[model samples]
Target chain A: MRAKTSAALNRSELEEELRAIGRRRYHDRHPFHELLHNGQLGRGQVQAWALNRFYYQRSIPKKDAALISRADSAELRRVWRQRLADHDGDEPGHGGIARWLNLCAAVGLERRKVESLDGLLPATRFAVDAYVHFVREKSLLEAVASSLTELFAPDIIADRMRGMLAHYDFVSNEAMAYFDRRLTEAPRDVDFALEWVLERAETVEQQESVLDALRFKCDVLWAQLDALYHAYVDPGHIPPGAFAPQDESTDRPRRYR
Target chain B: MRAKTSAALNRSELEEELRAIGRRRYHDRHPFHELLHNGQLGRGQVQAWALNRFYYQRSIPKKDAALISRADSAELRRVWRQRLADHDGDEPGHGGIARWLNLCAAVGLERRKVESLDGLLPATRFAVDAYVHFVREKSLLEAVASSLTELFAPDIIADRMRGMLAHYDFVSNEAMAYFDRRLTEAPRDVDFALEWVLERAETVEQQESVLDALRFKCDVLWAQLDALYHAYVDPGHIPPGAFAPQDESTDRPRRYR
Candidate 1:
């Protein structure tokens, strides 16, 4: 029976703020996603997305592993350990990263080209690196709170899975198995993180910091799409030494071993 | 003396490589500066430049202090201590940073606004933070070598001092005093660092590291101007929550207390 006060937000109030953040700031709201989902994007554009996203996908396990290393509680470790397992899997040729590479191959990018990362946009690298560094450098609560973007993730993943499959013939059910898994994993992860954050963020200052970390994560995600839209969409201001799509056509689906 | 192979560059060759890096990569060559120095930029652009460059100027004392804290030799400390004095000065009103704030005031930006840094572009902050991190984290010779951007600085400063004053009525000989001082200070500082680096970068690996450091520092500077150019000059995409110039006209010059 808690009443909301200016001193601090009750759980529901904090939840509302977090939801409002996702509503306003999520990459799901980015025009790139709108174009991406509706099949309006070129094949080269799709390939560019797959290629750049592989960097984020590959880095997730490392980010999760960094978080796990700093976890003081076994309960926290138990919940977070699943992130590493989900991302890294038990052995080689498995897990989300491998599936992402498969998507890259399906989208017609050479697997080695994505993995080498020599063609990454500086904006992509900086935005992603800033996230990893934020998690490593900020307080544990802030680190854990940053992942609350997952609170908004299930919807984006669903939209992406549905829209990408519908719009792009090059995309297939197999290329999207990654999202199917995320649909389940994200909700569970978000629930655990949400409950953990709500319980721990008792003070108004802590609540604000938690909220700000979520907003920061949203900016990180949004900036990636902004870079993509700028480079691939209007104005096409491709910086020097980033991956250049061969031509302005949709890539045919290809299988890679 | 070691013959020039894949292995080692002799002193003069290393100097040439460092200078060559400056020739190719310095921010002086950035299109932003081309517009800035040619008087092609509007007053808003000049004001934006002053506001952002303040972040770099104020950070100098802290950067120099970080390097000094790591220096192993008394001679190094004595020379480096002068950098501290030059930026921070003996008292509050005297140093390079204070002069920079005065310039900011002269350019019609609120000095308080520049000092608060709430108006800074994300790109400016990240680039400068990366430099501070590099100096704090890298080897001493590499840290010292990174400042070797100063080796190229005197020329840029002289050109800037002449060009800015020649072009902008708001800019005067007194307002130009900081660059004048830097013209004298940079060469002396660079000569000390260059000799220290050449004499001590005894291995090819160390030499390469020093060269890479100088290159990294160049990137730091070039990236800042790229942000300014992108936001102020060309596509004019100012990021959300950065300082927005009130009007396109050059600000009427004003002096500060």
Candidate 2:
């Protein structure tokens, strides 16, 4: 069992402790992450990563919608509604899912192929589904606390966006438009979420549950990278009956350059 | 998508295909499994595997109950109810779960600690929960088919029981009473389940779904092994917070000769 720090932390100290949890456990610390941010991964690996990650992105709004539906106050729901809008977008071909689709397209994955999730690892699906279930079933505070991983995301996104553009020839400014938007959006959302947690988690048990929720969310993110790293990055150990990179078509030129 | 065989297979062919699925995808093929059956793993690694696996064993009746609740026919429910009986038993401390607790006790794990599942891997929890959810939400045919892994369990149990007794001096005949029962119980259970699938999966799609359910069950079993391998077998690759072997205790002598 982890040692319990006294529940006497002031609001700022508690916030720092929560942010520290993110610093230590977030997916940005994972190895595949370094490969991704540094643009050291091959095109097919990137495509595989994006395709699998699309499952996570697509489920976010559904989880958030579940959170919204459970909220008693219209004001809380109104604040939560922005998350739905951000992911679902005003119309088709726009929101986070669409932006993720664009990343897949930029990496040369066919739209239909990406949409079908035909090639994703089973572990990836299980991990993402587990997250959706966690939010739907757990206390609302824990659900919101799970989203607090976003508090750490803006910095990682900055580092990743800069590193990818600087190191990779194939990546373009347009390819990473999703990260650009996330930089602004994540902090605003996370700020609200963090405050909601600090207010609701008055008891030590509630605070610990919120902390555990963040830890669980970190595991969800880290597990995805572990699957990708195991399957794509390290000698490409694809699990049985998951996506495989298509053979280069002889009809197409080897190099666009 | 896999090629669909014609819906009209003779009963023998259906059974063969089902057995073939087990041959290809069962946890016996997992690397940690080989270490287990070959006596290559250390005692701590062995203890960790047994501890995590208890979660799967404990969940079996609940998954079976979900299937029993969904069955419409008294005869079908009668067949499935046997599973509940087999696991839960007529009296306390007399069923499969109690048998599993005995196995854990033999491994030097405390009964309360094992039952608390405090030492379990997060992946183990998610994978088993996913199996329960799959049985509850999927078609009843798929739910019944998922238990079809029992068809292959008798052989694996034979191999595991023999290997553990031969390899580990700490394990005794009394400790492994769980397998003696499973060796008989599994075949009886599998025989009924195989007949159930053969009788019910009348369409190609239904057959395919049944096949897929077995595959999913295989993945669930395999994923638990994967978590064990990654955390215990692999050097320094433990997930953020999972079971850790206690530092070699000076007070207690090593159990193995």
Q: Number of the top candidate by lDDT?
A: 2
Question: Against the true structure, candidate 1 has what lDDT?
Answer: 0.80
TM-score of chain A of 2: 0.93
TM-score of each: 0.84, 0.90
Q: How high is the lDDT of residue B102 in model 2? A: 86
Q: Residue-wise lDDT of candidate 2 within A1-257, one digit each (tens)?
A: 23677655667877887988888889889888898888788776777788999999999999999899888989889999999999889999998889988888988888898888887777788888899889999999999999999989988999999998887776789989888999999999988888888988887778788888998999888877777765665535466667776545653422211
Candidate maximizing DockQ: 2
Candidate 1 regions with alpha-carbon error over 4 angstroms: A1-6, A28-54, A161-173, A225-257, B1-5, B248-257
Off by over 4 Å in 2: A1-10, A234-236, A246-257, B1-13, B90-92, B247-257
Model 1: lDDT of residue A173: 96
Native-referenced DockQ of model 1:
0.20
Number of backbone collisions per candidate, in order? 2, 1
Q: For model 2, how big is the CA root-mean-square deviation?
A: 4.3
- Scored against the true structure, residue A103 in model 1 reaches a CA lDDT of 87
What are the per-model C-alpha RMSD values against the true structure?
5.9, 4.3
CA lDDT of B13 in candidate 1? 90
